[model samples]
Target: MPMPDMNLLIALDALLEEGSVVGAARRMHLSPAAMSRTLTRIREALGDPVLVRAGRGLVPTPRALALQAQVRSLVEQANEVFQARDEVDMSLLERRFNVRSNDVFFGAFGGQLVDTLRVHAPLSTLRFAPEGEGDDDALREGRIDLHVTSRRNFGPEIKVQLLFYTRFVALAREDHPIFDAPITPESFVRYDHVSVSRRGRAHGPIDLALEALGLSRRVALTTPNFHSAIFSTASSNLIVSLPETVLWGMRELGLRMRPFVIPLDFEPVQVVQAWHPRCDKDPAHRWLRQTVKQICATVEERNAGVWPQP
Candidate 1:
């Protein structure tokens, strides 16, 4: 079957509304003769003389009357589809955004994120999902809205923006004997350590740094998250290494721990927020991204002197 010209729908709608060919022509900025030809096409397309002569005026046929409401509705919907979405009415926005991030990020900035949303988008909710191997797939499939973590090559398709940069710091119980003496490579390797690894692998950059100095620390315990490692270190002599941002968050939560430099040249980790290309222009998603960026900026400002610059 042949496709009908969509232009005819507009002409038909004008013709039915105006009733007179001259009036419809004026409404569409067309000549009377052009409108008459358009009505002819609409009749041919629909197999009906939608408007017919009635004395000195014209009236719509029963078929045209039946289609009047439907045509107008479709045209209105099409207009909305092409409209600009640069702004959103926050109070009217009722939606749930799923964010995937590690516990450290949540611990550091999640409270601020919630406070911002409460004042701006009161009705919207945030759902933070744990990071996993399927985060890329979840983002592509629309199962997740944003992915926040350390920056890595997520191929070329994912959109990423740097939130902040952080480096690891050694943490231990506040009164540990390590604090009584000057910290050096030798002393750092003397304490039994607690390692935090999501995959449960013991060795990391610290081990490599120690190996360079012909020294190694015993990893007495390995936990999956910074919270567990902090809890373990607070009550025991086991030392743990964690991002400076995570340690700051832990301090805010009243965890008794002390942070010290690792005494090794380690690259700073670039923490970033990532999203799928599909959500690049979504107003709600844009707002969420901006909020996260603002929170990170605040954190950076607050810790200007504490966290060393790269």
Candidate 2:
């Protein structure tokens, strides 16, 4: 079967509403001859002379009268499909957002973020997933709504926004020997270290920084997550280096540990929130990003001293 001309629907709508070829032509900004041709096409397509001469003006045929309301409704609905959505009612929005991040982020601000969402978008749910091996396919596939991390090599197509900056600090048992004297590059390297790496690697930027100072620390233990590193450091002499911001909520856990400044000068870690471009204009996704930013700001304020050093 042949497809019908969609343009004829607009012309038919104008002709029925105006009830005159000249008036319809003016409404559609077309010549009277062109409008007459369009009306002839509409008649042939519908097998009905949709408009007929009634004295000095045109009157709709019974079939055209029956279709006027339906045609108007279809045109109105089509117009709405192309228009921008300008408002969102939060209370009425029900959605689930899956956020992927390291354990440190969840341990720090996950509770606060959930609480904020409960108060603002009561019907929405938040899910946290662990950051697996630096892959971004979850975001591109829409499985993960947001990704929070310090490493930002998610490729050019992914949209990234800086959430906050943090610096590495040494975490050790409260009465560890490192606290007995002033920490220097020489003294800091003397203690055995516990290193955290998601990929199970033993060395990182800390090793490189120490190498530049003609010093090196012994990474006696390797852990995949911050919590394990903290537990290991708290119970033994192993000193662990982690971002200061990650320790935001650790105090509530009653962990017997203290943080001290790392002696070597290293670049600050940039923590960012990334998402796929597919959800850039979605109102619900936009709200999720804004809420994540607000939560990061609140966490930063509560732990002001953890910011990147100059």
On lDDT, the candidate that comes out on top is 2
Go through the candidates in order and give the clash count of each.
0, 0
Which runs of model 1 end up more than 4 angstroms from their true locations?
1-84, 304-310
For residues 1-310, write the lDDT of model 1, one tens digit per residue.
8888988888888898789999999999999999999999899889999998989999999999999867865664565578548888877799998988889998888888888888988999989998876446666555688999884768678899999888888888879999899999898988899988888889998898889888898999988888988888899889999888776565466866678898787687889998977678778889899889888987566555454345
Cα RMSD for candidates in order: 15.1, 16.5
Q: TM per model?
A: 0.70, 0.71
- Go through the candidates in order and give each one's C-alpha lDDT: 0.83, 0.85
Off by over 4 Å in 2: 1-84, 305-310
